[model samples]
Target: MKKKIISLFIILTCLFSSFPFILAAQNLKLVSNYALEDPRNLFYLDNNVYVADGTNGLKIVNVGDPNNPQDQGSYSVSGVCFDVFVAGDYAYLANGITGLQILDVSNPLLIDEMGSVVDSNYAWGVYVVDDYAYMADSDDGLEIIDVSDRENPVEVAESSSGGYAEDVFVLDGYAYLAEKSQGMRIVNVTTPTSPTSLGVFNDGSDIYGVFVEGDYAYLAAHGSGLIVVDISDKNSPSKVTNIAFDGMAREIFVENKIAYVAARSEGLILVNCTDLDTDLTVMAKLDDNSETGSGDAGVYVADNYAYVVDQEKNSLQVIDLTASGGGNIWLWILIPAILAVVVLIVRKSTAKKEPSRKEKLSDEEVEEESNEDGEESAVVGIEESESEKEEIELKSIPEEAEDSQEKSEESEQSE
Candidate 1:
């Protein structure tokens, strides 16, 4: 019985400790949404979100209060804004035909362009590092710019990829570009002046977005879904695996080993990418656009919230990524754990106690019976001793009588 209680306690501890995270996977809820016009991509920083609102240019929303997001500022550019990246007090935008445009967003409400440069090709996506900005210039491939002087930004060099460049993610001196028909192109950007193509992985999928973390590059492969590539060997990157879904995978954002995808018709999908070799499981999904028929086009995750851009709806949806039931789930786990502890304690207390009252009474009864038998034996011995004394006395009296008789006969003879 004690062993069973201990085993139950061990089981409950393990189960309760992991219960919250398991439930958290399916607890993504749509909290609030803010209106926008053709919002394309977004970047989260501090407590604000900078969005590339198509023809509306750059729009900044303060998400400090996720339940009630307010528009903080807006910037209207001459060209369509497809992507925006925020660094320090300035905003870098990939303004289609207008090319690379830098804005002084120190004052979100009154954002003003500090510099502007038009590339020979269209700027589809932009990534900023240090004093440089890497642009994915459609057919123009990769365009490197020097932004050391925000007032006079200049294109340092350009590398023409074989296919259309849709998105770019730079890490460890390599730029991983997602080319529409060419899969992914790995470029050695150690020297920004002249970046040469190191290798390419072409799976014939329409790759739209790329995000590199650690040693792998995650690609948003349109109809094919999310594709993982092993880039440990920069020159020869290989495909690790691909997770397929129904809708088009437009964009991807990864944080803390989880990939948040902007799946067009499928809404927002979260994939667990902690273990690439064995577990590429879809942990949760949110498809609340059934009525609108529009799908999610862009996603950015930070502080347990997902900010998604709904294409047709033209709105930014704020999703609460925290597990449901609030703080009550802890109570559920605590109840079971507390019960297991009670069982263990009760079993231990029982083991240290004496025998039952009935058993103790029976022992007392047997001892009383043995004491009565000893008293009876002592009484019988006393009675026998008295009877023997009386018999001896009677024998002595008879002997005296015989002696007296003999003495009287002797006297008579002498007379």
Candidate 2:
């Protein structure tokens, strides 16, 4: 009985402990899906979504109705579209190998190339601020372009850190570069004509994407997972902490204190970064099986839904964030109910095995049975005593017979 009670306690504890994981699993709900061809990157603007479709050029999807996203149109480019950034009425494209391509996207169905600057280095990423576009030119470092003249974009400033710049993000007056093997390099772009390196934080990890919010820079460091660095002092950036994931951290999108991460094969990983002073924790996770494709390459969160780009399936997955009731509440109610049922079943089984009160002997009957047992024991004791007395008499008779024989022998000898 004691062992059974211990087992029940252990089972209940485990069930309760699993509630958090169950809640996390059900948090993300797939609302809808839109298919594209080899979608590599995504960016959300107003009610439109721009996708960098390899070979297919830029594909636009109007998501005004999130539940039913409609394909607006597409424009073909000469090179493979790698990344995109939309500002005002124009869309900037990082055309791999072909260099930077600009397009006027005022009309979703009629996007036209405004201008482009051809460079020897492959343009992997781009970030636009004011009249300038900071391009992550692979091996060539940062190339700043002036887009004020939309018809004729020109390279106003260019600087090289001697590292492979994979992605770039401009904030305040600085350009944050995710340099492949060099970790993060901060460049002072207040003076775009002569961009100079302010500082660098090297962890020797391959950084693929970077996003800065407040004083911390969240880096999607490929195999090393998500690395958080304090960049309040640009000249001396320090590591805050790192949150490791099972798959490669490809890209990250922050909204409402939540870090929406595109974890390649692992899918979308939601992390809570409300407080960076402490270790970052995974709030929830959505895998490929969750109505998304196997290869999660990019993520963009706007309004109440998260738009995920899957390179493997070449599709865009929209996940609902406003849906409710899929939390630990149900688990809380279920655990106790299950425990109660188990307890009742165990009690019922115990009750059936226990003897009924009516079946038990009355006090008088018990006394009568005890008296009979005592009488039987007394009788057995008397029989044992009688057997011993008989044996003693038989022994005495043998001794007397031996004594008579000895007396007769002595008389014969004397005669």
TM-score of each prediction:
0.76, 0.72
**Model 1, which residues run further than 4 Å from truth?**
1-7, 10-21, 290-294, 325-415
The RMSD (Cα, Å) of candidate 1 is 9.5
For model 1, residues 93-114, the per-residue Cα lDDT tens digits are 9999989999999998888889
Candidate 2 lDDT over residue span 231-257, tens digit each? 999999999988897887888887766
Model 2 misses residue 139 by how many Å? 0.3
Q: State the C-alpha lDDT per candidate.
A: 0.85, 0.85
Best by lDDT: 1
Which pairs of residues have clashing backbones in candidate 2? Answer: none
lDDT of 2: 0.85
